[model samples]
Target: MGSNAPSSAAQLAARAELQGFVQVTDSRAPLYARLAVGLADDTEAVSLLAAAPASARIPVTLFAAIHDLLLADPSEPLAAWYPNLVATPRTDDPVPAARELCRRRRDDLLALVTTRVPQTNELGRSAVLLLALAALGDEMGPLALLDAGASAGINLIPDRLRVDYDGHQVGPGPLALTCGVRGKAKADRLPSAVPVVADRRGLDLRPVDLGDPEQVRWLEACVWPDQTDRFDRLRLAVAEVRRTGVVVQRGDVITDLPAALAQLRSGHPVVTTSWVLNYVGEDGQRAFSAVIDDLGRDRDLTVVNYEEPDLTPGLDWSAELATESLSVLRVLRWRAGERSVEYLATGHPHGYWFSWLD
Candidate 1:
């Protein structure tokens, strides 16, 4: 989570410089605006927000992502992405203005990158998927879980908040999964996992520590304003992390997988991630899958992912851009040579969706 208060003038400058690059890529601006705010770097963002007051309506967390995206690679789509944002309608708050800009530029960027990258990882998908994994373990016992792009480790605390499905209920709170399942199933089998035993952890290139109030707020600001449950879930997750402490190491996922696995019990099932792998390039994807494959061959392993099902690389302008609805969530389970997959849900990467997997 780092310090929400930008650490120094130099750090703020670096973050702003990163935002400048992200804004160039229409896909990156909404997030860039938020990260610029979160890192406490965007004075223009702050000033704009103060005047517009649309900050509450904005997806502020995207800014941090924009910072990361630009810092990682600053060419191609981003150059066009930034200006697209400038063309978007400006609201009272800098955040929404930034988000609208991203939305406006999404089509152009989608054409630019085609569908090579995934756009979002909303908490609703993560919540259901984790519950499903826990239920799957009801058949195989509990497992050790590792997440990539964990961003403050919020998803790791899925058990801490409440989840409901139709008439079924689960969680430390009362929230439930509302998506309709294909077949009639017994609600009794749903997970009633005690928050205590879930061995959860994650790795993020920029791991956000939830212990800090300011950092937590920035994460809070990232949630869309319309979803009250999402906000509640995020708050519960932060509280859980603060109370129980989470194992979120600050490092690259590829380099850290081996060590992360070493910490898990040998027989415990290993679940990799949800909506985090898409940011990685081809080589990194292969290396990561290879690591997971090796783990499955030698150790108990399962991969639960909620990523865009389509990987079509060419430019597809016909597809709708800007919203997270384009992304589909899928789960992968490993066993020897078999790679089992099930489509679970779909929505904005960070927006809302129904889950049929539970």
Candidate 2:
């Protein structure tokens, strides 16, 4: 019989990655933490993860693939532990069930991780986006939004969704998002009115078609299994997008930006990128900046970036504020060929909360 076991080095690397994920994950997500610990020592599971591309070898991608499978077939024993799949998740140890599912569905899991990268248009971040938009509107009036790396363009509609920043509410829509405010930000500092989004467009290499059920399910699967609130919000946001359609064009952020910008005819153009520059590497990030700088020569423009501090180039504070755990929210603007930047706030990657800095 042919042996399919992974090499010792591969197994060691996978174990280290899973262990690191457990350490960094929020304490509330106990299920994933436990699952990662259990799978770290499992040779077969680690082997499957080893076969995936370097970028997709992390715990999030592995668990998301499993979650995708569970969403399709909730009959699996592992589904009992997932709050999204069960009315009341079982408190019993779920490692055995998870291992069994991994053993039985090894092929399926491998295919998913090999083919798909974890994609999330995290709606929670809209709270931060809304805040940024309010600041821009205060200075420049109504805005045109162009989202780079917009997975499903769901975030392109922050203006239509309600966000309660520690009791201060914004927006008049049905889907409500709660974001905790910290630091110098006060309730009165929030804009009295939500900024009007005159035009909204998104650029993604492969945009999710909400019209397709599978694509919708994939988006749902990307949510952490323990965060049931996020899952519920995602469903609501998806529905809102369906009711009122969005336009997400197929294109690259660097190459096709000018054409996409040309399509927007109203308001001052504001480019927004949330956790996207990291995927492009240092050179690509520099290239993207050059593109924006070149474009700003003829028109007044603004860029709002919610990304890892180290990954974003040209931001003066990126080196000083770099941290693995938080995302920095910064704004870059150009007028009459002169450039300026605003370091707005730093927050959780998912926008669960933020600490404002003047």
Candidate 3:
């Protein structure tokens, strides 16, 4: 089974690109990236991560997630090495340290990534939703949000979070996500307030329940180990969700689209998919696009879509997708049979900051 491995070199390369991208954009994540890159020739690491390629193709995300789990659980030995535990961590070459940690707990770590998908429920990205809602203008009146691949469905309630784009503020709400404005973002018209979300619902193949301690732990695991601020944000989002529960159903997005759309009660129904479509096959994605288009033909449906340019079709986007192979945020609308898709911003997968694309 050495040469007949399930995870092809291309899958490993995708993990590399994701790691390299994160290594550059986020200072805290470089350590994890280094460990991921170290696995290029390390047989143990490769075999451990790609035990089941279908689930492990995106090893970097999965690995980071498990680290989140181990780090949070004080009983795990790796938790001692976790930088967050001690204010001043032993930061001298984290790759070797990481390898040692994995070597020590090979079975447990292997078991974690083999089953878990790259489930990052980043509620911080709700800022992008606010931007999309603002782009629609007040004429759309109230909003009805339908989130695909919504994970824990915390992102469905972006209005409940505050967003700040380089001091251009939005929402006097619960959570605050501040992003540095860059490139065309400085010139583009940003949102001053969170849109009025009258109603919301989310669809995920495996919807995570925040009320469940185990699910909450896995969600925490999905977050990168280095990003303390993100972890804090996750805690806040979890609390909010527990306080006011969200409606997230577990079902196939393609098959569930009709029923999901039918559930929208009032106001302009806006469908938003952020980083979720990447998991769907090309055929599935085409079908997903077609479904939205077909629905738009009859009613006024606005779709806010964001995905990695590499994952999107007909995406002759900007330098981020072309050069860096990054995530691009887009705002699209179909009203009275007229449709428009616009690239609004490009940012890290975890929403550190976004360059507004005018």
Candidate 4:
């Protein structure tokens, strides 16, 4: 019985994490919020979550796993409550049905929670990336984008998607992404036209293959079910990516930086990382910085990082910014062996909105 005490304690901790997630989640994602609340009190659910690696033992990962199952088979009773599955989600409690599914599909859920990592590949973030690219293009001319940790490389083609920045539109697209503009940034600041993409390449440890339905389903599962618009946009982005194939080399971003940079033949090389550094640890982040600095010795280079302020090293931005849900958009440029860092903007982690800083 004493040996079981540690496991029991771990379940309690995992349950607490779920309760906390419910507090911070957007009020609009009521279904997930409610599930988190219910799952917090479910012994079986908490135990399943506790079995996952400490880093993967989060409400989002667990919920996404369940979402993936539903996406594959929405015939379950709980599917009726998922907005992505049904046009009108029932208002009644979904916890009972959710619990039943967890009990019946324990082994499947366990496999997913233990192995899968959440990969949002949020297309909304394309707005943030596009803005940064345009700013760089104003000075650098055409740019070759090298995406670090670019899952499926959806962001590799932001110029191909239509982005409406408060009535200002960019891209000729199949997918339209909208970001609310705030603060001092002006639409006129963007280039008269979208930046010319000399080339686009991506480096990821495990890049998603758009051709695989299961792989694509996991990407969709990562999105909250209540955000139907995000789910729809993801579908459009996937179609666009399928139409224009992207090359995502399977390699570590830190060690493979130079090789990836070599693939770009012309135009300024711009490397972008979004929500990727958090997984790389502090040492990896430092190494990535070192690699960029080393490569910049002979030529001009730029790195645009959209990451949590604290997770991103070498920048002295306020600690307060890290505490907020917002992610910072920072641009680092190397000219003549000199490095300069600029804090460009702050925005929603998913890039639904942003407040630019001059």
* lDDT values for all models: 0.51, 0.84, 0.71, 0.84
TM-score of each: 0.57, 0.91, 0.80, 0.91
- Candidate 3 lDDT over 1-358, as tens digits, reads 4653336665465445444655564666755655566654455566566564564466665466457557556666446455555566555555565566667777777677666666678876777656677666465878888898888887887767778788777777788788766676553477766677788888999999876777778777767667778888888888886666678888877789879988989868988888888778677777888888889999898888767868755334455455445667877678799988777777777666777665
Off by over 4 Å in 1: 1-122, 172-198, 226-228, 311-327, 336-339, 342-351, 355-358
Off by over 4 Å in 3: 1-28, 33-47, 61-72, 92-107, 184-188, 314-326
Candidate 1 C-alpha lDDT tens digits along 147-225: 7777776666555556555555566653343433334454554567633334877788767666655455446544433
TM-score of 2: 0.91
The candidate maximizing TM-score is: 2
Which TM-score value belongs to model 1?
Answer: 0.57
**Model 2 error, position 238 (Å):** 1.7
Candidate 3 versus the native: TM-score? 0.80
User: Candidate 3: which pairs clash?
Assistant: 65-221
Which residue pairs collide in model 4, if any?
none
Q: Residue-wise lDDT of candidate 4 within 83-202, one digit each (tens)?
A: 889988899999999899889999989999899888878888888877788878878998999999999898888678777888887777667888888886576765355677889899
| Residue 346 alpha-carbon offset, candidate 4, angstroms | 2.0
Q: Which scores higher on lDDT, 1 or 3?
A: 3
